[model samples]
Target: MTLEQARAALAAARRVAVLTGAGVSAESGIPTFRNAQTGHWARFRPEDLASPEAYRRDPKMVWEWYAGRYRNVTHAQPNEGHHLLAWLERDKGDGFFLATQNVDGLHARAGSERLVELHGNLSTARCEACGTVAPLPEPNTFTPPPTCPVCGARMRPNIVWFGEFLPELALEAATRAFEKADVALIVGTSGQVYPAAGLALETRRAGGVVIEVNPDETELTPYMSYSVRDVASRGLAALMGEG
Candidate 1:
Protein backbone atom coordinates (compact mmCIF):
# COMPACT_ATOMS: atom_id res chain seq x y z
CA MET A 1 0.00 0.00 0.00
CA THR A 2 1.04 3.62 -0.33
CA LEU A 3 2.52 5.65 2.55
CA GLU A 4 -0.64 7.63 3.07
CA GLN A 5 -2.73 4.49 3.27
CA ALA A 6 -0.31 2.92 5.75
CA ARG A 7 -0.31 6.09 7.84
CA ALA A 8 -4.07 6.21 7.85
CA ALA A 9 -4.26 2.63 9.03
CA LEU A 10 -1.80 3.36 11.83
CA ALA A 11 -3.58 6.55 12.82
CA ALA A 12 -6.92 4.83 12.99
CA ALA A 13 -5.71 1.87 15.01
CA ARG A 14 -6.56 1.86 18.72
CA ARG A 15 -4.08 -0.82 19.79
CA VAL A 16 -0.80 -1.56 18.02
CA ALA A 17 1.81 -4.28 18.25
CA VAL A 18 5.25 -3.91 16.66
CA LEU A 19 7.67 -6.70 15.92
CA THR A 20 11.26 -5.94 14.93
CA GLY A 21 14.11 -8.08 13.69
CA ALA A 22 17.82 -7.63 13.08
CA GLY A 23 17.12 -5.45 10.06
CA VAL A 24 16.06 -2.65 12.38
CA SER A 25 19.44 -2.62 14.07
CA ALA A 26 21.39 -2.95 10.82
CA GLU A 27 20.96 0.77 10.26
CA SER A 28 22.72 1.38 13.57
CA GLY A 29 25.81 -0.57 12.36
CA ILE A 30 25.16 -3.81 14.33
CA PRO A 31 25.43 -6.84 12.07
CA THR A 32 22.71 -9.46 12.02
CA PHE A 33 23.59 -12.68 13.91
CA ARG A 34 24.43 -14.61 10.72
CA ASN A 35 26.46 -11.73 9.29
CA ALA A 36 28.43 -11.18 12.51
CA GLN A 37 31.05 -13.80 11.71
CA THR A 38 34.10 -12.08 10.24
CA GLY A 39 37.83 -11.61 10.76
CA HIS A 40 38.96 -14.34 13.23
CA TRP A 41 35.43 -15.68 13.42
CA ALA A 42 35.15 -16.31 9.67
CA ARG A 43 36.53 -19.81 10.01
CA PHE A 44 33.92 -20.94 12.54
CA ARG A 45 30.21 -21.54 12.17
CA PRO A 46 27.98 -19.23 14.20
CA GLU A 47 25.84 -22.11 15.46
CA ASP A 48 28.90 -23.89 16.74
CA LEU A 49 29.75 -20.90 18.87
CA ALA A 50 26.19 -20.20 20.11
CA SER A 51 25.06 -23.56 21.41
CA PRO A 52 25.17 -24.76 25.02
CA GLU A 53 27.50 -27.58 24.06
CA ALA A 54 29.86 -25.04 22.56
CA TYR A 55 30.22 -23.49 25.98
CA ARG A 56 30.72 -26.90 27.63
CA ARG A 57 33.52 -27.72 25.22
CA ASP A 58 35.10 -24.27 24.97
CA PRO A 59 33.71 -21.72 27.36
CA LYS A 60 36.40 -19.16 26.73
CA MET A 61 35.84 -19.18 22.98
CA VAL A 62 32.09 -18.82 23.33
CA TRP A 63 32.54 -16.05 25.88
CA GLU A 64 34.96 -14.24 23.63
CA TRP A 65 32.51 -14.31 20.72
CA TYR A 66 29.75 -12.89 22.91
CA ALA A 67 32.04 -10.32 24.46
CA GLY A 68 32.92 -8.98 21.04
CA ARG A 69 29.26 -8.83 20.08
CA TYR A 70 28.42 -6.99 23.28
CA ARG A 71 31.13 -4.44 22.66
CA ASN A 72 29.94 -3.90 19.10
CA VAL A 73 26.27 -3.51 20.08
CA THR A 74 27.09 -1.19 22.97
CA HIS A 75 28.71 1.27 20.62
CA ALA A 76 25.82 1.34 18.16
CA GLN A 77 23.00 3.90 18.47
CA PRO A 78 19.30 3.33 17.86
CA ASN A 79 18.04 4.34 14.41
CA GLU A 80 15.01 6.43 13.50
CA GLY A 81 12.80 3.35 13.38
CA HIS A 82 13.58 2.68 17.01
CA HIS A 83 12.95 6.31 17.94
CA LEU A 84 9.63 6.34 16.11
CA LEU A 85 8.48 3.18 17.86
CA ALA A 86 9.46 4.63 21.20
CA TRP A 87 7.41 7.68 20.38
CA LEU A 88 4.45 5.47 19.52
CA GLU A 89 4.71 3.69 22.84
CA ARG A 90 4.85 6.98 24.69
CA ASP A 91 1.93 8.38 22.75
CA LYS A 92 -0.24 5.30 22.86
CA GLY A 93 0.72 4.19 26.40
CA ASP A 94 -0.95 0.87 27.28
CA GLY A 95 -2.26 0.57 23.73
CA PHE A 96 1.19 -0.04 22.28
CA PHE A 97 3.62 -2.94 22.66
CA LEU A 98 6.92 -3.92 21.05
CA ALA A 99 8.39 -7.35 20.50
CA THR A 100 11.90 -7.67 19.07
CA GLN A 101 14.03 -10.64 18.04
CA ASN A 102 17.27 -8.70 18.09
CA VAL A 103 19.61 -9.11 21.06
CA ASP A 104 20.93 -5.57 20.72
CA GLY A 105 19.48 -3.20 23.33
CA LEU A 106 18.62 -0.53 20.78
CA HIS A 107 14.89 -0.49 21.51
CA ALA A 108 15.45 0.06 25.21
CA ARG A 109 18.17 2.57 24.43
CA ALA A 110 15.76 4.47 22.23
CA GLY A 111 13.34 4.85 25.18
CA SER A 112 10.84 2.10 24.40
CA GLU A 113 9.22 0.99 27.65
CA ARG A 114 6.63 -1.64 26.74
CA LEU A 115 8.89 -4.12 24.98
CA VAL A 116 9.76 -7.79 24.85
CA GLU A 117 13.26 -8.79 23.77
CA LEU A 118 12.28 -12.22 22.43
CA HIS A 119 15.81 -13.47 21.76
CA GLY A 120 17.33 -11.94 24.87
CA ASN A 121 19.82 -9.07 25.19
CA LEU A 122 23.59 -9.18 24.68
CA SER A 123 24.33 -6.69 27.43
CA THR A 124 23.50 -9.14 30.23
CA ALA A 125 24.94 -12.44 31.39
CA ARG A 126 22.96 -15.27 32.96
CA CYS A 127 24.23 -17.93 35.30
CA GLU A 128 23.76 -21.32 33.67
CA ALA A 129 23.39 -23.10 36.99
CA CYS A 130 21.34 -20.78 39.20
CA GLY A 131 19.74 -18.57 36.58
CA THR A 132 20.97 -15.32 38.03
CA VAL A 133 21.23 -12.47 35.54
CA ALA A 134 23.79 -9.68 35.61
CA PRO A 135 25.32 -7.06 33.36
CA LEU A 136 28.18 -8.33 31.24
CA PRO A 137 31.64 -7.14 32.08
CA GLU A 138 33.44 -4.74 29.77
CA PRO A 139 35.10 -6.43 26.80
CA ASN A 140 38.64 -5.64 27.90
CA THR A 141 38.04 -7.06 31.37
CA PHE A 142 36.08 -10.15 30.28
CA THR A 143 38.95 -12.59 30.23
CA PRO A 144 39.20 -16.16 31.59
CA PRO A 145 35.46 -16.31 31.05
CA PRO A 146 32.88 -14.97 33.48
CA THR A 147 31.88 -17.09 36.47
CA CYS A 148 28.77 -16.51 38.50
CA PRO A 149 29.92 -14.89 41.71
CA VAL A 150 26.89 -16.31 43.51
CA CYS A 151 26.92 -19.90 42.27
CA GLY A 152 30.51 -20.21 41.04
CA ALA A 153 29.15 -21.63 37.79
CA ARG A 154 29.70 -20.44 34.25
CA MET A 155 27.96 -17.31 32.98
CA ARG A 156 26.58 -17.20 29.49
CA PRO A 157 25.20 -14.38 27.39
CA ASN A 158 21.50 -13.87 28.04
CA ILE A 159 20.67 -15.05 24.54
CA VAL A 160 18.60 -17.80 22.97
CA TRP A 161 20.79 -20.22 21.06
CA PHE A 162 20.06 -22.32 17.94
CA GLY A 163 18.25 -25.16 19.72
CA GLU A 164 17.04 -23.28 22.75
CA PHE A 165 13.54 -21.98 23.45
CA LEU A 166 12.67 -18.30 23.55
CA PRO A 167 12.09 -16.92 27.03
CA GLU A 168 8.68 -18.04 28.24
CA LEU A 169 7.44 -14.76 29.68
CA ALA A 170 8.48 -12.81 26.61
CA LEU A 171 6.80 -15.33 24.34
CA GLU A 172 3.51 -15.21 26.24
CA ALA A 173 3.55 -11.43 26.42
CA ALA A 174 4.22 -11.10 22.68
CA THR A 175 1.43 -13.51 21.88
CA ARG A 176 -1.04 -11.61 24.02
CA ALA A 177 -0.06 -8.32 22.43
CA PHE A 178 -0.50 -9.75 18.94
CA GLU A 179 -3.84 -11.24 19.87
CA LYS A 180 -5.26 -7.94 21.07
CA ALA A 181 -3.70 -5.54 18.62
CA ASP A 182 -5.74 -3.55 16.12
CA VAL A 183 -2.61 -3.25 13.99
CA ALA A 184 0.60 -5.26 13.80
CA LEU A 185 3.69 -3.51 12.46
CA ILE A 186 6.45 -5.82 11.26
CA VAL A 187 9.79 -4.22 10.55
CA GLY A 188 13.10 -5.37 9.10
CA THR A 189 12.58 -9.10 9.77
CA SER A 190 12.91 -11.62 6.95
CA GLY A 191 10.32 -13.82 8.71
CA GLN A 192 12.63 -16.84 8.70
CA VAL A 193 12.86 -17.24 12.46
CA TYR A 194 10.03 -19.23 13.89
CA PRO A 195 7.99 -18.67 17.04
CA ALA A 196 9.00 -15.03 16.69
CA ALA A 197 7.99 -15.14 13.02
CA GLY A 198 4.78 -16.81 14.08
CA LEU A 199 3.66 -13.66 15.89
CA ALA A 200 2.83 -12.02 12.57
CA LEU A 201 0.68 -14.99 11.68
CA GLU A 202 -0.95 -14.87 15.09
CA THR A 203 -1.80 -11.23 14.61
CA ARG A 204 -3.21 -11.92 11.15
CA ARG A 205 -5.22 -14.90 12.38
CA ALA A 206 -6.62 -12.76 15.15
CA GLY A 207 -7.96 -10.36 12.49
CA GLY A 208 -5.52 -7.53 13.15
CA VAL A 209 -4.30 -5.45 10.22
CA VAL A 210 -0.70 -6.52 9.55
CA ILE A 211 1.72 -4.02 8.02
CA GLU A 212 5.20 -5.02 6.92
CA VAL A 213 8.07 -2.57 6.51
CA ASN A 214 11.01 -3.91 4.60
CA PRO A 215 13.05 -3.05 1.52
CA ASP A 216 12.18 -6.44 0.04
CA GLU A 217 9.27 -8.81 0.31
CA THR A 218 9.41 -11.36 3.15
CA GLU A 219 7.65 -14.62 3.96
CA LEU A 220 5.09 -12.47 5.76
CA THR A 221 4.25 -10.41 2.66
CA PRO A 222 1.30 -12.59 1.77
CA TYR A 223 -0.24 -12.02 5.19
CA MET A 224 0.32 -8.29 5.37
CA SER A 225 -2.43 -5.74 4.84
CA TYR A 226 0.23 -3.35 3.53
CA SER A 227 3.89 -3.88 2.61
CA VAL A 228 6.09 -0.80 2.55
CA ARG A 229 9.20 -1.55 0.51
CA ASP A 230 11.78 0.60 2.22
CA VAL A 231 14.51 0.31 4.83
CA ALA A 232 13.44 0.20 8.47
CA SER A 233 14.22 3.81 9.43
CA ARG A 234 12.61 5.28 6.32
CA GLY A 235 9.65 2.91 6.32
CA LEU A 236 8.84 3.46 9.99
CA ALA A 237 9.30 7.22 9.61
CA ALA A 238 6.86 7.25 6.70
CA LEU A 239 4.37 5.16 8.64
CA MET A 240 4.58 7.53 11.60
CA GLY A 241 4.19 10.59 9.34
CA GLU A 242 7.77 11.73 10.03
CA GLY A 243 8.98 11.27 6.44
Candidate 2:
Protein backbone atom coordinates (compact mmCIF):
# COMPACT_ATOMS: atom_id res chain seq x y z
CA MET A 1 0.00 0.00 0.00
CA THR A 2 1.10 3.56 -0.58
CA LEU A 3 1.84 5.97 2.30
CA GLU A 4 -1.39 7.81 1.51
CA GLN A 5 -3.32 4.55 1.82
CA ALA A 6 -1.69 3.87 5.20
CA ARG A 7 -2.62 7.32 6.44
CA ALA A 8 -6.16 6.99 5.14
CA ALA A 9 -6.60 3.64 6.91
CA LEU A 10 -5.55 5.18 10.20
CA ALA A 11 -7.69 8.29 9.74
CA ALA A 12 -10.81 6.35 8.74
CA ALA A 13 -10.62 3.31 10.98
CA ARG A 14 -12.89 3.48 14.01
CA ARG A 15 -11.28 0.66 15.94
CA VAL A 16 -7.50 0.65 16.26
CA ALA A 17 -5.12 -1.59 18.16
CA VAL A 18 -1.50 -0.81 18.92
CA LEU A 19 1.33 -3.09 20.04
CA THR A 20 4.62 -1.60 21.27
CA GLY A 21 7.98 -3.01 22.33
CA ALA A 22 11.49 -2.27 23.60
CA GLY A 23 12.43 0.15 20.84
CA VAL A 24 9.75 2.55 22.09
CA SER A 25 11.23 2.48 25.57
CA ALA A 26 14.72 2.92 24.18
CA GLU A 27 13.63 6.17 22.57
CA SER A 28 12.83 7.49 26.04
CA GLY A 29 16.33 6.49 27.24
CA ILE A 30 15.20 3.46 29.16
CA PRO A 31 17.54 0.57 28.49
CA THR A 32 16.41 -3.03 28.25
CA PHE A 33 16.94 -4.98 31.44
CA ARG A 34 20.02 -6.78 30.18
CA ASN A 35 21.47 -3.53 28.94
CA ALA A 36 20.60 -1.76 32.19
CA GLN A 37 22.71 -4.16 34.22
CA THR A 38 25.83 -2.68 35.74
CA GLY A 39 28.53 -3.62 38.23
CA HIS A 40 27.14 -6.60 40.21
CA TRP A 41 24.10 -6.93 37.95
CA ALA A 42 26.23 -7.17 34.82
CA ARG A 43 27.44 -10.61 35.83
CA PHE A 44 23.99 -12.23 35.74
CA ARG A 45 21.95 -13.19 32.70
CA PRO A 46 18.37 -11.93 32.24
CA GLU A 47 16.97 -15.26 33.38
CA ASP A 48 19.04 -15.05 36.53
CA LEU A 49 17.06 -12.02 37.70
CA ALA A 50 13.72 -12.50 35.92
CA SER A 51 12.70 -16.12 36.28
CA PRO A 52 10.36 -17.76 38.76
CA GLU A 53 13.13 -20.16 39.68
CA ALA A 54 15.46 -17.29 40.38
CA TYR A 55 12.88 -15.49 42.54
CA ARG A 56 12.21 -18.68 44.41
CA ARG A 57 15.92 -19.15 44.97
CA ASP A 58 16.38 -15.65 46.34
CA PRO A 59 13.39 -13.35 46.31
CA LYS A 60 15.41 -10.55 47.87
CA MET A 61 17.91 -10.52 45.06
CA VAL A 62 15.16 -10.49 42.45
CA TRP A 63 13.24 -7.74 44.21
CA GLU A 64 16.38 -5.71 44.61
CA TRP A 65 17.06 -5.99 40.92
CA TYR A 66 13.54 -4.87 40.08
CA ALA A 67 13.81 -2.05 42.62
CA GLY A 68 16.80 -0.71 40.78
CA ARG A 69 14.87 -0.91 37.53
CA TYR A 70 11.90 0.88 39.04
CA ARG A 71 14.22 3.65 40.06
CA ASN A 72 15.62 3.74 36.57
CA VAL A 73 12.24 4.08 34.86
CA THR A 74 10.96 6.67 37.31
CA HIS A 75 13.98 8.82 36.66
CA ALA A 76 13.44 8.79 32.91
CA GLN A 77 10.97 10.95 30.98
CA PRO A 78 8.48 9.76 28.39
CA ASN A 79 9.39 10.62 24.79
CA GLU A 80 7.24 11.97 21.95
CA GLY A 81 6.45 8.43 20.83
CA HIS A 82 4.67 7.77 24.13
CA HIS A 83 2.72 11.03 24.10
CA LEU A 84 1.52 10.56 20.52
CA LEU A 85 -0.08 7.21 21.33
CA ALA A 86 -1.73 8.71 24.38
CA TRP A 87 -3.09 11.49 22.18
CA LEU A 88 -4.31 8.93 19.69
CA GLU A 89 -6.13 7.18 22.49
CA ARG A 90 -8.01 10.40 23.20
CA ASP A 91 -9.26 10.56 19.63
CA LYS A 92 -10.22 6.88 19.45
CA GLY A 93 -11.56 6.49 23.00
CA ASP A 94 -13.03 3.02 23.55
CA GLY A 95 -12.22 2.18 19.96
CA PHE A 96 -8.53 2.16 20.89
CA PHE A 97 -6.53 -0.52 22.65
CA LEU A 98 -2.80 -0.56 23.38
CA ALA A 99 -0.73 -3.55 24.40
CA THR A 100 2.93 -3.16 25.21
CA GLN A 101 5.80 -5.57 25.78
CA ASN A 102 7.53 -2.85 27.78
CA VAL A 103 7.45 -2.86 31.60
CA ASP A 104 8.79 0.59 32.38
CA GLY A 105 5.39 2.29 32.93
CA LEU A 106 6.34 5.14 30.59
CA HIS A 107 3.07 4.89 28.66
CA ALA A 108 1.08 5.27 31.83
CA ARG A 109 3.11 8.28 32.83
CA ALA A 110 2.49 9.69 29.38
CA GLY A 111 -1.35 9.57 29.97
CA SER A 112 -2.44 6.29 28.37
CA GLU A 113 -5.23 4.61 30.27
CA ARG A 114 -6.68 2.15 27.73
CA LEU A 115 -3.65 -0.11 27.69
CA VAL A 116 -2.10 -3.29 29.08
CA GLU A 117 1.44 -4.21 29.95
CA LEU A 118 1.85 -7.63 28.31
CA HIS A 119 4.97 -8.35 30.34
CA GLY A 120 3.68 -6.59 33.48
CA ASN A 121 5.41 -3.49 34.88
CA LEU A 122 7.91 -2.41 37.53
CA SER A 123 5.75 0.28 39.18
CA THR A 124 3.85 -1.99 41.57
CA ALA A 125 3.99 -5.00 43.89
CA ARG A 126 1.63 -7.98 43.91
CA CYS A 127 0.43 -9.68 47.03
CA GLU A 128 1.64 -13.28 47.04
CA ALA A 129 -1.20 -14.29 49.33
CA CYS A 130 -4.17 -12.21 48.17
CA GLY A 131 -3.21 -11.22 44.61
CA THR A 132 -3.77 -7.51 45.14
CA VAL A 133 -1.47 -5.34 43.06
CA ALA A 134 -0.34 -2.04 44.56
CA PRO A 135 1.98 0.71 43.41
CA LEU A 136 5.45 0.60 44.83
CA PRO A 137 6.55 3.20 47.36
CA GLU A 138 8.29 6.35 46.23
CA PRO A 139 11.66 5.45 44.74
CA ASN A 140 13.87 7.07 47.34
CA THR A 141 11.97 5.61 50.31
CA PHE A 142 11.42 2.11 48.95
CA THR A 143 13.30 -0.94 50.15
CA PRO A 144 13.31 -4.38 48.60
CA PRO A 145 10.23 -6.67 48.78
CA PRO A 146 7.40 -4.37 49.78
CA THR A 147 4.65 -5.94 51.85
CA CYS A 148 1.05 -6.19 50.64
CA PRO A 149 -1.29 -3.60 52.12
CA VAL A 150 -4.31 -5.84 51.66
CA CYS A 151 -3.01 -9.07 53.16
CA GLY A 152 0.11 -8.10 55.03
CA ALA A 153 1.89 -10.81 53.08
CA ARG A 154 5.14 -10.41 51.25
CA MET A 155 4.59 -8.62 47.95
CA ARG A 156 6.63 -9.50 44.92
CA PRO A 157 7.39 -7.17 42.05
CA ASN A 158 4.37 -6.97 39.79
CA ILE A 159 6.21 -8.52 36.88
CA VAL A 160 5.47 -11.55 34.75
CA TRP A 161 8.50 -13.68 35.36
CA PHE A 162 9.71 -16.29 32.90
CA GLY A 163 7.56 -19.45 33.06
CA GLU A 164 4.54 -17.30 33.99
CA PHE A 165 1.56 -16.58 31.80
CA LEU A 166 0.61 -13.05 30.82
CA PRO A 167 -2.40 -11.92 32.84
CA GLU A 168 -5.35 -13.79 31.33
CA LEU A 169 -7.65 -10.76 31.20
CA ALA A 170 -4.98 -8.58 29.60
CA LEU A 171 -4.11 -11.18 26.97
CA GLU A 172 -7.77 -11.81 26.18
CA ALA A 173 -8.58 -8.11 25.81
CA ALA A 174 -5.60 -7.50 23.52
CA THR A 175 -6.49 -10.53 21.43
CA ARG A 176 -10.08 -9.43 21.09
CA ALA A 177 -9.04 -5.93 20.06
CA PHE A 178 -6.62 -7.25 17.43
CA GLU A 179 -9.17 -9.68 16.06
CA LYS A 180 -11.80 -6.99 15.66
CA ALA A 181 -9.66 -3.98 14.78
CA ASP A 182 -9.84 -2.14 11.49
CA VAL A 183 -6.24 -1.01 11.85
CA ALA A 184 -3.41 -2.44 13.92
CA LEU A 185 -0.32 -0.34 14.54
CA ILE A 186 2.73 -2.36 15.52
CA VAL A 187 5.62 -0.17 16.63
CA GLY A 188 9.21 -0.74 17.60
CA THR A 189 8.93 -4.53 17.97
CA SER A 190 11.27 -7.19 16.65
CA GLY A 191 8.12 -9.22 15.85
CA GLN A 192 9.89 -12.31 17.19
CA VAL A 193 7.94 -12.53 20.45
CA TYR A 194 4.59 -14.25 20.46
CA PRO A 195 1.70 -13.61 21.12
CA ALA A 196 2.52 -10.03 20.30
CA ALA A 197 3.38 -11.44 16.86
CA GLY A 198 0.22 -13.48 17.08
CA LEU A 199 -1.83 -10.29 17.57
CA ALA A 200 -0.48 -8.86 14.31
CA LEU A 201 -1.33 -12.14 12.59
CA GLU A 202 -4.83 -11.92 14.00
CA THR A 203 -5.20 -8.48 12.42
CA ARG A 204 -3.98 -9.98 9.16
CA ARG A 205 -6.45 -12.89 9.37
CA ALA A 206 -9.31 -10.50 10.00
CA GLY A 207 -8.39 -8.51 6.87
CA GLY A 208 -7.39 -5.49 8.92
CA VAL A 209 -4.73 -3.00 7.91
CA VAL A 210 -1.47 -3.85 9.68
CA ILE A 211 1.09 -1.03 9.78
CA GLU A 212 4.52 -1.62 11.28
CA VAL A 213 6.83 1.20 12.36
CA ASN A 214 10.46 0.30 12.84
CA PRO A 215 13.88 1.36 11.64
CA ASP A 216 14.48 -2.07 10.15
CA GLU A 217 12.24 -4.71 8.66
CA THR A 218 11.14 -7.27 11.23
CA GLU A 219 10.00 -10.88 11.28
CA LEU A 220 6.46 -9.70 10.63
CA THR A 221 7.44 -7.15 7.98
CA PRO A 222 6.51 -9.57 5.25
CA TYR A 223 2.93 -9.62 6.56
CA MET A 224 2.42 -5.89 7.08
CA SER A 225 0.06 -3.78 4.96
CA TYR A 226 2.88 -1.22 4.91
CA SER A 227 5.92 -0.26 6.90
CA VAL A 228 7.42 3.11 7.87
CA ARG A 229 11.18 2.83 7.97
CA ASP A 230 12.02 5.11 10.90
CA VAL A 231 12.27 5.24 14.67
CA ALA A 232 9.13 5.31 16.83
CA SER A 233 8.86 9.09 17.34
CA ARG A 234 9.24 9.96 13.69
CA GLY A 235 7.25 7.01 12.41
CA LEU A 236 4.30 7.58 14.71
CA ALA A 237 4.41 11.30 14.00
CA ALA A 238 4.21 10.56 10.31
CA LEU A 239 1.30 8.21 10.88
CA MET A 240 -0.57 10.90 12.83
CA GLY A 241 0.12 13.48 10.11
CA GLU A 242 2.30 15.53 12.44
CA GLY A 243 5.69 14.70 10.94
Whose TM-score is greatest here? 2
lDDT of 1 by residue, 109-141 (tens): 999989999889998889889999887777667
Query: How many times do residue backbones clash in model 2?
Result: 0
Where does candidate 1 clash, by residue pair?
Answer: none
- Weakest lDDT window of 10 consecutive positions for candidate 1: 137-146
Q: Lowest lDDT 10-mer window, candidate 2? A: 234-243
lDDT of model number 2 = 0.93
Compared with the true structure, model 2 gives a TM-score of: 0.98
| lDDT tens digits, residue span 1-243, model 2 | 988889989999999999999999999899887788989999998899999899989999999899999998999999999999999999999999999999999999999999999999899989989999999999999987899898799998899987889999999999999999999999999998778689999999999999999999899999999999999999999989654
TM-score quality measure for candidate 1: 0.95
Residue 226 error, candidate 2, Å: 0.3
